[model samples]
Target: MAPPTRACKYGLDCIRNNPAHFAKFTHPAKLVATRAAASSLSTSKKLKNQKPILTSTPNTDAPPSLSASDDNRDFDAEVVAATHPTTASIVALVSTAVAPDVLANISGVTPIRVLADGDKIAISSYTIKRTHDHYYCTCPAWSINNRPVDARTCKHLKLVFGDAYEAARLLWKDPFGNAPPAPAIANKPKRKKQEDKASEDEDEENDANTKKASSTKAKKSKKNSDSSSSASSSEDDDEGTAATKYSAKNRAKREETKLKMPALLLAQKFEPTKTDPTGWWISEKLDGVRAFWDHERQEFVSRLGNLFTAPDWFKEAMPKNISLDGELFGGRGKFSETVSVVKTNNSPHWRKIEYQIFDSPSMASQPFEDRIAKLNALYPSKAASFLSSQSSLPSSSSSTATKNSHIKIVVHEKCKNLQHVLALLKTVESKGGEGLMLREPQSHYIGKRSNTLLKVKSFYDAEAIVIGHEKGKGKNSTVTGSLKCQMASGKEFKIGTGLSDALRIKPPKIGAIVTYRFQELTNDGVPRFPSFVCERIDANKPSDAVVCILKKD
Candidate 1:
C-alpha cells in the first residue's frame, strides 16, 4: 500500500485522537474546508521545530489593564506564537469543535453582535467583533483609546465568552478541562444545579457574614443611641419649659404616611454642543430634595413615596388639580438640611424651605415648554395671594416665612447657543451654583432617564443595581466596605468612597437601585471613579429596573 499524504495523515490522526471531531463532517463544504485546514496545519508543523518570529509589536498605547498587568497582559498572541501551534493549526482544531451554527451567527465579514438589553430600556447592546487575533468593541472604552490594533481585550469580550475567552487566547491547553478560575472582580457567573453543594456552601458563608454584620451593627447602634440619648436628655432638661413640650408634640405628630413613589423624569448627562442648546430650555441644576406633590392626596411625597408631613397649611396651599415635580430648596449648599427636613414626618425645619416647582407630572403628556408654561401660570410672579405675606413678623422671621413657605415656579430660559450655555454655566458656577439642566423643547415626560433631559454638570452621575455588600474594616468594621453594583451591561464593580457614613453603616439592600457619581465611563461602559451617591428610593426592584444611562449612537 502507498504511504498516506500529509493531509490524509493529519486527518487520520485528528480522527484517531477524537472521532467526535469528524462526526459532523456530513457537510461536503465543511469537509473540504476541514481538509484544507488540516493540510495547512500539516505544512505549518514543518516550521514547529524552528524558532518563532513575532511580527506584530506590542501595542503600548492600549488602554490600561482592568486588573493586574501580568494577569491581563496581551501576551496571549505572543504566547501562542512561541509555545503553542500556529494560527492555522489553532483555528483548524478549534473550528471542528465549534458548532457550524456559530458561523451562521457571524455578521458580514466579521462576526459582530450587539446584545439586546434586558428591558430594551437602555442604550442597545454595543457591537463587538472578532477579527483575526484581536477583538474590537464599539464602546467608549475601545474607541477612546484610538482602537489599538494589538490583541487587547475589553470587558465586553470577557463578559460574553467567559471561560471560552481563555480558549480564544490559547490560554486553555485543554478546552474540555475545567476553565481557570475567573477573578473575583470579574463577573462571577451563576452556578449550575450541578454545583448545588457548592451553592449551599456559599449560602453558609453569606449567613455567617450576615450574622457578624448584624451583631456589629447592633453593638454600634446601642453605643450611638446611648450617647445620643444622653446628649438629647441634657438639652431637653435645659429647655424643659418649651423645647421639651414642643419635642413631644413633634414626636406625637410624626405619623408614618406611606406615599406613592413619584413618577420621576431623570436626566441623562451630556456635554453641551452649539446646536444642542438651540432647541433646549436651560435651568439651574438645583441641589435640593426632589419632592413630588400629590394633588389628590394633598401631600408632598419624597421620590421614594414617603410622605413629607408638611404642616396642614402648607399642603392646603398647594394646587389641588395638578401634581408638580420640583425640589425642596432652603438654598444652595443646603442639601443635608433638605434631606434632614424631608426624611422626617414633621420637622419644624420645613418652615425654612420652599417648593420650587419646575415640571408638572400631570402635564407629562404635553410638550415640555407647554408644561413649563402651565406650571408658571399656576404660580404667576404677580400672584401675591400665594406668596408668603407674613410681613407683620420680624425682618428675619417675616422674610423667611414669605420666602420659605411660598411655592415658586422654577424659571427656565430658552437656551440660545452653546456659547450662551457656557456663559450661563460660568455665571452660575461662579456664583456657587451647581450646574445647568437642559430639557429638549418638545420632549414629553417619561418615567425614566432619557436623552431628552440632560444634566450638564461638571461631574456625571448614573444608576446601577446593588449586587452585594463587602464588609468594612477597622473604623468601618460594623458597616460595609463597598457596594458591589452591576450595570445593565452585566458589568460589576465596587463603590465605597462616596458613600455617606450612615449609608455605609446600613448599606442599601442587595438588588436595590443606587445612584453613583463618576468622572466618566471606561471603554467597557464601567464607570471610572465610581462612588455611591445615593439609593434610588423610587427605582423599581432590580429585577424589573429600567434605570441605566448607556451611551447611545
Candidate 2:
C-alpha cells in the first residue's frame, strides 16, 4: 500500500488544513469545547499529535509571563485581555462561570457534582477537605501545578458552578466597611426667632427632677446607715450574756449530735469471731475537708468555724433551715491544698470545694430512710430523685416552697451488717482514705454517738509538748498517772497509751516536748485518745510544742 497521505484518505484528518480552523483550536473556550468533543471518541489514535493551535492577537498590556511562552503567547494574551477590568469584577466573572458539578468532582471524596442545561445547573451536595488552607482535587488535571492553586480554586470547582470561588473572595468584605466619610460643615448664617417660653419650663422641670432623685438617693443611704447601726447595737448587746448562752446551747447540741468526720479511725487488727465480730462499712472515703454546715446562718462552718472563709457559691448551695454534716471535698488527693484554701481569709479556690453531705441534723428526729429521703429531695438532679416531691423541701416548709434549691445531698446505700461495714473501712484505708461512717437505720438522729453513728479511721501520729501531770488514782495512787500534753496546734489532750511502764513511772521531764499518735480529732479540738509516739529534743518551750490550730483565717 502507498504511504498514507498527510491528510488521511478517509476524509477524517488529525490536523486541520485551514489556518483559521487551527487558530480557533487555540482559543481557551474553543479548546475546551474541542477537548470535550475529542474525549467522547473511543479511539485514542485519532487524537494523537493534536496540539492546541494558536492565533495571533495583539498584547498591548500582556503580562510578562505570558509573553515568555512563544507557542501560546497570543492565546494567553487574549485570555488575559478578556478578564474583567477590575480584580473584583474578574473574580465575580470567574465565580459565575465555574460549574458546581466540576468543582464537586474535583475531589472524589466529596465531589461537588453539577448537572447543567444551558442557564440552569443543579449542584450535588458534597464536603471538601481543606489542608493548609488549600483545596486538593483527586482529579487528573490537578497535578499540572503539582499543588492546588494559590487562590485555592480547583478545576472541578471551575467546571461546576463557573467562578463561584472568585465571588466568595469578593463576598469576604470588611464588616466595618470603609472609614466613614467626614462630616460636612454648615456655612449658612443663623436665623433669629422668638424663644419659646415652653423651652425654659422644660429645662426647669428636668432640673427639679434631678434634684428630687439626688435627695431620694441620699435619704435611702441615710436609712440604710441607721438600720445598720441598729443591727450592730443589737449584736453588741447579745455578745455578752446572751451570746454565751447561745454558744453554750449550740455546743451542747453539737456535742449531743453525732457528726461524721472524714478522719480515719485506727482499730486493732484483730481477727473476727462469731460472737464478737469486727464491724465495718465499705465506702469510698472522700478526700474532703470535714465541714459542719450551719443552715441557720446559711454558711458552711468548718470543725472550727473561725478557721475558714466559705465562698458565697458554697453558701448559695447550702440548704436553708437544715444543718448538714458532710465533707467539703475538692476532688481527690488535695487534702492539704484544700485545707490551705479553706483556711485563707478569701480564696478563689473555695468555690471548687463542694459539700458531700452524708448526714442531716434536722432529720435527727426521723428514721434513717426518712432523713435520707429528705436529703435526696434537696440534692441536685443527678444525685437522687427518689424522695417524694413534698419530702424534698426543707422541713417545716410548705410543699410548694422553694429554698436553698441548688444544694445537692447524696445518700449512699446502707450496709447489711458490721462485716460489710468493716470491709468498706478496709477498702477506704487501703486507698489512702480517712475512714467509713456507720449509721444505724433505726436510730434517731442525735449529736452524740447515741448508738446512731460511728466513725472508723487509721492511726496517725501528731507531735505535742508535755503540759501537766495528773495525780494517780485508785490502786496506783502513789505515782503520777496521766501525762497531759498540748498538741503543736494548741490542742490539749492526755496521752495515756503507748507508754512503757518505766516511762509511766517517771514521764518525760515536765518541760520536755514529745510526739503523740492519734487516730482522729475529737469535737473539743482534742485528739481522739492519743498515744505517746516519741520524745522531741529540739523544742525550746514546752507550750510551743502544742499542735498549732490550722485556721483558714
Candidate 3:
C-alpha cells in the first residue's frame, strides 16, 4: 500500500462515501459485502444494460461562453460544485495519493512500542501510531519537532523505523506500476525553500562527520596511540553507536580488550555437616582484588572485567603463554590500597603489590591437585626444590632473574582431618588473616560457586539489601549516619559502624546488596555489633534469612 499524503483524507473519504463508484479501492471483505448488497437491491442484468456515466460531467446548460456578468457566479452554486467530488476527479486524486515517492516511504517505516523511564518511582510508555498511512510517535522528540502532519519525521521515528529516512525518500517506487506523472510546480518560492532545506541537511551531515573525525584524532593522540589503538578505537566507535550512560572517552576505555574472566571455581559458605575438611588443601583467603592475568594480552582484569593496568615492568616477569588466576595483594588488610594501585593506568604503587598465583581457568578441566601442580611447573616458586627440579629446561631469563620474580605461588597445605582444619583456621585468625579456603582434593574446577570449595571465617557475616539512609548528627551532620537495611526474612536494621567518611557522604544506593560482619546473634536473633564490610556486587539478595551462626571456639 502506498503511504497516504497530507491530502489523503479528502480522496479516501470521497471513495468511502461513494463506494459503488470506487469499489476496487476497498478491502476484499468490504467489496464482497458491497457486491452482495448491490445484487440484492437490483438484478445484475439491469446494471449491465445501463450506460456508464462519469460522476463529474461538465455543465452544458449554461451559455458556452460566459460574459463578465455571467462569470459573477451565484455563491450557492459555487459552494455546491466545490463540495461534491466527481468520480473522474476522485480517481485522479487516488492516483496522485499513491504516487511512487509517497509509497516508498510507507514500506520502510515500522512502529514499535517502547517503555521509557519517567520519574524516580514512575514509568511512562506509549505506542507509535500509523493510521491511514500517516506516522506519528508519542515521544518527546516528535512533539519537540512540532508534530509534523506531512512527510517530516523526528529522531524517534528514524530510530524506531530505521535510520534510512533519506534513502527511503530518494528510492521510493510505485508498487502497482501505474504511478501518475509528478505534477508541475509553478510556485518558485516553495521549491526554493525545499532546495535550501536539503542543502542545510547536507551541510549538517558534513559538519557532524568532520566533528567525529576530529574527535577520533584527538582521542588517539590523548592516549599515545599504540599499535592496537586504531583497531580498538574504530571498534569502540562502532559500539558507541548504541546509547550508553558513560562518556565517549570512558566508553572507549571500557571497550578495550581486558582479561577474560577466569572461570575458576568459587567457594560456598562452610557447612559443618555436609562438608568435611579431611585431606583437603587449605589456604588463607587473601583479602585483595581478584585479578586474572591474560597471558595472550599481557593484561590483568578484575572479576567484573575492568582492566587492572599494572606497570609493564611489573608484568614482564609473568609467563607469556600461561594465564594465571590469583589475588593482587599488598599483604593482609591492604585491599583498598592494592585496588588503588592496580586500578591506576600507571603507578609506582604496583611495585608493592604482588600477584599470588593459585589457579588457571584454561586448565579448569583438571582436578584441583593437578591444576595446582601444572601452575607450579609453569611459574616455579623461589624455593630451591623448584629450581633444582626444573633446572634442565631452557629458562626465559637467568636463574637469578627467575629467583627475583615478584609473583608468588600460594602454598596449599593438606589438612589431616576436621581438627587440623580448625587448628589451622585458629592460627590464621590469631595472625589477623582474613579467612581459610578449603578445596576438594579430587574435584575439578568449575566456573560457579559450589560445595567443592568452602570459605571458613571467624566472624559471622550476611548480605542485606540497603533500604534507606539515616542522616548523621553533630560532627557527622553533613554526612549519612547509617544505612537502613532489610534481611530476606523482612527484618530491618541500621548499620552505623565501619562505614568510612567517604561512604558516609555518599552511601550505597537503596536497593544495593551489601555484606556486613557481626560477632554473634542477640537473644532476639539480630546481628550484634554489625559492621559494614563491603557491597556484594556479585551477589543478589540472598534467599536465606540473615541470622548469625554461632561457631564453637
Candidate 4:
C-alpha cells in the first residue's frame, strides 16, 4: 500500500477512524496505519483488519503495534509516555529493559504537522531528525553553531516543537536508576506581568515538591517498549506537553557552551584644538547601524553578542574565515531604513543594504596603514586619498555598486591641515553626512576607546534613560508628545525633536536607554538643545562618556 500524500484539513481533531477516511486523507497519528495493517496480516493472519490501530497480538513475535479504545486501557502506555514526556520518560527510554539503542528516537515518525519552510521562520527543504536523545538539523544555522552536538538546535525546531522542549531535552546519565518526574512546563509571562509579580516563588516551590514525590513511580512504568512502537509521536500533543517550563535550578543542569563576547574598538571625541588632522586618515563618518561579522559562526552579532538572522544569500557573499568590524549601511542618512531592515529576521530588504567594512579584528596586531593596504588588495576599492582626487559635489555616497557586490571598503583621505578638515566637515554635514572620522597614521586597532581613532561631529551625542513620557499637544495628543529622559550625571531634560512619526506614536519603554544629540551644555549642566537619535539595543545603561564634549570640531 502507498502512503497518503494529501493532508486532511481537520487533522488531529478529526474523529473519523474508519478505513475510508484514512485512505482519503492522512492524519499524523495514523501515518503508519496503512503499512502496519499490511505487515500485521503477514505475521498473524488471524485478527481481522477492520480497525488499523491494533495490528498485532500481545504475544506476537513481531513488534507490538499500539492498541487503543477497543476494550483494554493497557496499550495507552506509549501515549501517556509521549504526551507528558519528562526527564523520567527519557530515563525509562534508556532503561536496562529496553534495547540500548531504543532511547529518545523519533526519526521514523512523521512531523507533528506539515510546515512550509523558508525566510522569516522555517528553513526550506531542510531536514530535522532526532535519534536516541540527540537532534540533527541539516540547516546552515544549526550546522554553524559552535555548541556541542547534543545542545545544537535551529529555528526550525524552535518553531515546531518549541523552546521549552529543547531546553529540557538534555540526557540523563543514570538511565537505569529511578528518575524524577519533570516539572510542569510554563513560559515566562509578558513584560508588564513580570514587572508586577508575587506568586512565582510559591509556584516554583510546588513544582520542586511534585518532581521529588513522583520520581520512583514514573520510572517503574517502562514496559520493555523499545520493541513497542507507535504510529506518530505528535498525536497527544494538546494535553501531553510535559516539562514545558522548568525551574531555574532545573534549567541550570542542561548542557551549553557559553557564547564569546566580541571585543570591538570604541571611538573617542575629536578635539580639533588639541588633536592634529595634518597627518591622519580622514573618512566620512557614516550614520549606519553597527555590526560585527563573526566568521566562526558565519553570522552577524551585535557588540553585546545577540545574533542577527541575515538572509542566506547576503551571508554567502561574505568571507567564512576572516572576521570583519563594520556597519550595515544603506547609503548616507538612511539610518532608519537600514535599522528597520536589519532588525527583521531574514528580511528581503537586506538586498538594499551594503556591508561597509572599515576595520578587521583579525588584523588588529598590524598597523592601520598595513590594514588598509590589505583591504585594497582584497577588494575593488576606493583609496583613502579620494578627497583630493574629487570635489565634494558628487555625494561621497555609493552608486549602482551593490548590484555586483555586497561589501565596500570605506574610502579614507589624508588630512591636509586643521582648516581643510573644518571645511570638509561643513561640506559633509551639508550633504546629510553624520560628520567625519580621523584615524592616526600607523595606529593599531585596540578594543578600548583611545586617541588613535576620533569622531569629528559638529554636535555632541550621548545616551540617557527613558524615564518618562509626556502627552503630545493638539493633533499629536493621541501619541507621545515628548520623552522625559535623565542623563548619567542626574540631569533631566525633555527631547521632542528628531523623532519619527512612527516612534512618537509608540515610544521606547521606560527603562530603555536611547542615544541623543545636543549642541552644547548649559551652565546648569543640562544639554542646551537635546534631540533623540534612536533607542540603543546593545546596552541598557549609559557610559560615563554620556554627553561627550568636543571643542569646535
Candidate 5:
C-alpha cells in the first residue's frame, strides 16, 4: 500500500488537479494542519524569528548574479488577519521596488507562478520571490507550518518553477549557495515563519541574516532617542515610530548607497562647414534603445542607468570578458518595436532584436579604431556570410553577427570627404534609416557630448516625460489629442502631431519618457512643431536627459 496522504503544503489553496499531486498530498479543510497534511513536519520545530534589517537594492550597473547564498525573500501581499500572537507579526509590507515592471515584463524571471497541469497561471495575482535556490511563499500554511524553513514548499513555488524544480531546490544540501542579494532599496520583505519554525528560513537562513541586523526595535529606539528633543523616554516608548517605519515604504533604512551611474559617450550634431569628415569613421545611426553591457554582472543597463532584461540566450551570445556600449536594434524604422521588446522583462521578442555595437566602454582609454578592432576580434565565427566586406577595414573586422545568432557589429566605413558623408546620409535616410553617425579618427571615447561623434538627421529629436494628456478637438474629439510633456529643464510642451489612432486612444502612461521630433528649439528653448516619435527609457522617475534640449532621440 502507498504511504499515508500528506497535507498539501498549500493547504486548501493547493488547486492542482494533477492526479500526481492528489496522490501525494491531501488538502486540509481547517487552518490547523492535520496529521496527514503536515505528516513530514517535526512537531518540535522552533520559530527562527530574528530581528529584521534593511536590505539594499542591486547595483544599477548589473543584475544580481544567480548564486545560491540565501536571496529568496517573500515580500507578499497585504496580510489578511492581525498577528496570530502565537506566530510572528506581519508588521510591514514591501514598498514598490525600482523598475519592478522590468522584472515582471520579462517572461519568466519572477517567482509568481501557475500549475502547468493544473490551470492557467496569473503571475500578477501573487507576490512571490523565487531565487536560484531559495523560495518564499505568503500562504499561511507554508509560513506557519510546523516544518524546517529549508524544507518548506508551497503550491505557488511548484507552479512557477514546476514540480521537478521545486523538489530539487528543497533537497539541495547548500540552500544558501546564492550570494547575498542586497535586500530592497525600495521595499523591505518582512521576516515571517511557521508557528513552531524560524520566521524567514529553517535554521541557518533567517538566523544568519538576522544576526547581522538583529534588533529592529532597538535600532529605532536609538534613532528616536537621538531625534527626540521634545520628549525622551524608554525604548518601549518608540513602538509607534518602529511600527511606522517598519510598516511601509520608509522601512528600508540601510546605508543610502545610490546606484553608480554609468559613464558613456554622447553625440553632437554635424555642422556641414564647421566639422571636417575626412578619414572619420562613418556608420548608420541605428534607431534603437541605447544599452551598456556590464560583463562583470552580466546584465544590460540602459543609457540613464536602468535595466533592460534580455533573455539568457540573448546575453550568452555577447562577449563575456569585455564591457560594451551599443544599441539593442530590431531594424530601421522599428524603434518603437525595439523599445517594446527590450523594456519588457525577459521578452522572447528579443529574438527579433540585435545588439548592434558601436563602441566598447571597457576600451574607453583606447582610440575609437582600436575599440572597433577589439569588437571585431571577438566576433563569433557564426557571423552571416552576406555581410559587408572587411577588405576596406582592418583584417580583424568581420562582416555580420549571430552567436545564438543575435548581436551584430555596426558596420563602420572611413569617410573620404564631405560628399561621402552627405551621400551616406542620403542613402540611409532614403531607406527609412534614422541618419548617419560620424566618429573622429583616433579620438578616445569620452563620456560627455563632444565633436568626436556627430549625428546627421533631417530633423532634430529629443526626449520628454509625459506629464498629462488632453482630449482631441473636431473629428478626433473622443480620443486623446495631445500628451502634455515636460523636459529636464522644467519646460513643458504638447506633442499631438504624429500620434497614431492607437496611441491617441490609449496614450502612453503619464511620466513615460517619449521621443519627439522638431525643426529647432524656440527662443524660449521649447521644441518647434514637435511630433511624437516613440517611448524611450522609463523608470517612472525624473528624466536625467531632461537637460538635453536638443539631444538626438
Candidate 6:
C-alpha cells in the first residue's frame, strides 16, 4: 500500500489551502474531501448513539488545563468564540456535554452524582447547583466576579469541551485555513515602593542599635574615670614621697630602661606517678602568652612592658588596682605569633589575645585566696551600669576616662594530685603545646618562686652549677672548651652537644650555674646525654648538693 498522506492523518484542512499540492495527487481533491467529511459525519453519529464508557484506566496523554474545582465557563466560551467564530455555538454545546464527566474524573468523583437534567450540575458539599442560564459553585475560584460558574470557563468547562469540541473544529475550516491569534491580557501592578519602605525600616533599626551601643560605652568610661580619681586622691598623702621619686622626668627615664622581665622557669624532668610529691600543689598549665599586667601604670602591660590598648568593652571587664601575672593567649597553637604581637606597641592583633591571669603579683604579701577574692570582686558576673555603658564618640577621646577598669581574667584551677596535673599537661601537649605550670594553693604570689611555683614540661634537663671546663673536640677543639658542670643533685655531666661557635670561645665561668638539656640517668646517678641550653644567672645551688658521677660497675 502507498504511504498515507499528511492530509489523510490530519484531515481535509491540512490541504484545504494548498491547491498546488492537491493537483499532483492521483485522487481528485473533491473526492478526498467528500470521503473525509463522510467519515467525520459517521464518527459523530456513532458517538451520539453510543453511551459514555467509564473505564478504570485514566487518560494520561491529555494535558491538564485548570484544576477540576475551577469553573471558567466564560473563559471557555470566549476561547471557543475566538478560535471557531462561525461554529462557537456548536463548540459551546459539545463543551457543556463532555465537561461534567471529564470534571468528575479529574476530581476523583463520579459524574452520576454531579450531573443533573437539562445541562445542570450539583456540587453537593457546597449546596450549589448549576445550569446553562444560571450556574454557580460555592468554590472560591468561580466567585472572582460573581458570574455564573458556566460563564467562568474554569477547569470544569475545559473538561466539558473535551474531544467533541476539537472534533467540531476539525470539521469546520476557515477560508484562511490558519490558526487563530491568542487573546491579550492586562499587566499587573508593581510593588517597588512597599519593598523600599521595608528596606528603610530595617536600616533605621540597625542605626538605633548602633546608637544604643555607643551610649552604653560612654557611660562606662565616665564611671571608670570617677573611680580612678577617687583612688588616686585617697593615696595622695601616703604616696607623696614615692610619687615625687617617680615624677614625670624620672618616669620618662625609667620607661627608657629596657628591663627584661624574667622568662618562665621550665621543669627539666617529669615523673608520671599516681601520688603527689610532698609540698607540691598541681595546677594546669594554660597554652597562652606570658603576660604581666602593671596595675600602678593603669595599663595592661605585656612581659616586655609594651602597653596593650584594649577596647572599652574589654577594659571594663579587667580587675582594677592590682598587677596580675598570667598569659595572654588566643586559644592554643598560636603562642609564638601571640608573643610577637604582644611585644609590639599599638598592634591591633592583641585584641584577639585573652589575659589568663593566674596570680596577683602586686599583692604578693597577701594570701593567695585573698588575692583571688579581690580579683573576683573587681570583675563581677553582672557588670555595674557604669561599666556596661557605651560611648557616643570614638575610642581615641574615650581612653583616659576608661582607664583602671576591669578586664576578663581566667584563673587556672589547682589539681588534687600529680597525676591530675600530668594528665592536664599531656592533654595540652597532645594537642600541640608547650607545658604546664604548678602553683601552690596556699602560697602567696612571691616575686621569686619561694618553692611555691614550679613548671612542668616534657623532656628532662638539669640546671648544673658550672665547676670547670674541658677542651672542645672536633670543629670546636681550637675554640674555647667543653662545659664540665655539677647538677643541683651534685652529679657531674659533660655537655658535648648544642655548643655554638660563640659559646665555645667563652665557656661559662666557674661557679656559674647553666641549664643542660639531658635524657635519662646513668648507673652512677650521673646525667646521660647532656646538651647545653643556656646559663641560669638567676638560679642558686641548694645546700645539700652532692657530686654525681657515672661509673661502669
lDDT (CA) for every model shown? 0.49, 0.41, 0.50, 0.54, 0.53, 0.41
For candidate 4, which ten residues in a row score worst on lDDT? 190-199
Off by over 4 Å in 4: 1-246, 249-258, 382-404, 460-553
Clashing residue pair totals per candidate (backbone < 3 A): 1, 59, 0, 5, 24, 33
Residues 344-371, candidate 5, lDDT per residue (tens digit)?
4333466777777879988888998888
The local lDDT score (0 to 100) that residue 112 gets in candidate 2 is 18
**Candidate 4: tens digits of C-alpha lDDT, residues 321-347:** 688887777655555455546644433
Of candidate 1, the 10-residue stretch with the lowest lDDT total is: 192-201
Rank the candidate models, highest lDDT first.
4, 5, 3, 1, 6, 2
- Using lDDT as the measure, the top candidate is 4
Best to worst by TM-score, what's the order?
A: 4, 5, 3, 1, 2, 6
1-553 per-residue lDDT for model 1 (tens digits) = 1221223333211222122222322223333333333322223344445432233334222211122332322222322333233444435443554324332122211111212211111122566654322344554333322111222233455543332332344222122334433332212221111100000111011000000101000001112346556554433232121111223333334323334457688777766443367868877776567778888988877665655556675665688898888777666544444544543333345676777787887988899888877775665553322112332110111112343345767667777788877887765554444567888888999977778888775556777899899998889888898999888678877897778888888888998998887644443456656767788889764322232342121
Position 181, candidate 2: lDDT: 20
Model 2 deviation from the true structure expressed as Cα RMSD, one decimal place: 32.0
lDDT of 2 by residue, 226-301 (tens): 6556554433332122212223454456445423331211122323342232332223445556666776666655
C-alpha lDDT of residue 511 in model 6: 90
Tens-place lDDT per residue, model 6, 481-552, is: 578777667666677678788888888889987777643354345654567888877887622223232111
Which ranges of candidate 5 are over 4 A from the true structure? 1-258, 380-404, 460-553
Question: How well is each residue in 186-248 modelled by candidate 3, as lDDT tens digits?
Answer: 221011001001001111110000100111221111244564664455333322222122346
RMSD of each: 25.6, 32.0, 29.4, 19.7, 19.5, 36.1
Judge candidate 5 against the unseen true structure and give its global Cα lDDT, from 0 to 1: 0.53
Off by over 4 Å in 6: 1-281, 302-317, 381-408, 460-553
TM-score per model over all chains: 0.38, 0.34, 0.40, 0.42, 0.41, 0.33
Model 1 Cα displacement at 394 (Å)? 23
What would the TM-score be for candidate 2 when compared with the true structure? Answer: 0.34
